[model samples]
Target: MNSEKQKLSVLIITLNEEQHIKSLLDDIDFADEIIVVDSCSTDKTVSIVESFKNVKLIRHRFVDYTSQRNFALDQAKNSWILFIDADERLTPELKSEIVTAINSENVASAYFIYRIFMFKNSRLKFSGWQTDKIFRLFDKSKCRYNEERTVHEKLIVNGPIASLKHKIIHFSYSSYEDYKSKMYHYGILKANEKLAKGIKPSFLLQLLHPLYTLLYQFIIRFGFLDGRKGVIICYLNAYSVYIRYKELRTITSSKI
Candidate 1:
């Protein structure tokens, strides 16, 4: 271990995430600063965060994911920012690797960290999650999330990008109902994003696209290998697609 610690700012965006906030804060205590941009959480999230004297919590209104993330970026005092989610966890090995990476002589502007997705305490190995990676650790001076994306935000890095060796453990959903609600929320956001781009919905696509998604995830992506849980995940994923177009149609129809 290095005797000197790096000047790093850990950023997190939260909304009613009382269940996982404490553990996440404890894990990243090695950082010099921790900034949490909360979206007016009604739960004990704000109170729990206040317990940590080192954490700086800012209450911001909920908009899109991109805007929330970009707003978090602006509040960071350090140049190096590790933007992690409330549902994600970092291992001891990964913590060491992160320190080494930033302290290296030839460090990249941004680094991609892979994750192991979990559904209801079960590790999901398939359903298009095998290659799940996100740009969590990066230089704030050279990177910012794309504003156009409302759901799955994309990070635009001005310099070189690299990948980390260790992976994060992502507890994606607490229950089936929770997962379904999250998917539906993502679907609605996606629909609004498409509408903003002047893209209209089609009835045929709403019907066929979901079926294709089911088949592609379960059969092509080997989701069947995971057994019963895989089937549920695949179905819900397809359902989210259906809900997206359904909501889009509902929004478009109200104009008349």
Candidate 2:
């Protein structure tokens, strides 16, 4: 009867995430190895990471989310990998569950972890964030991020998948301005991804898609149930869609 615990490696990709790095590092201290692939952040992020003797920091050039994550995957030495974001925190229940799952004899290739989205101090219950989940923990040898996606990267798991009970606390936005900037950045990345896949943008798409998104999120998804926060989130979601098409049009038009 062999009884050896599985070694876990934690990977985090960061860029000027000084505010969340330290706390996140503290939370994931149980890992056998911790790797932080930074995009040359011009902040105290690197220094804060350096304070953790257990963390291995690698500065890589920013290409896209998928590439950055894949780069981090290559750097991991352990069989089990937990890819966590700087702004996300794993609760004690989730951490314990992860430890138990990896140590079990019949472990899945990957696990889907749900997230509780937070806007500053408030936790938004709606705004299309009710069913947010991500593949964060998995076997390093069996999973890799999809190269095609640049913004919202998806994992390509080779084997069986399972879902965890507890959820990760995602402190998504620090401020309104910060959230808007991130949405715009994500919109640009998504537009580039669509362009790569030979997808063209239309004026009607730029106009109507945003309206549809606003209605779908605010009304259909019950975003309005959350009140003021819901309104802001739904509007931003619509704005992101508008920016995506608007950017796609700009890029295509420039080539002509």
How high is the CA lDDT of each candidate model? 0.92, 0.93
Worst 10 residues of 2 by lDDT: 1-10
lDDT of 1 by residue, 151-212 (tens): 89999999989999999999986888988999999999989998898889899999999999
TM-score per prediction, in order, is 0.96, 0.98
RMSD of 2: 1.2
TM-score of 2: 0.98
Please report, as a residue range, the 10-residue window in candidate 1 with the lowest summed lDDT. 1-10
RMSD of 1: 2.1
Clash pairs, candidate 2, are none
Name the regions of candidate 2 deviating beyond 4 angstroms.
none
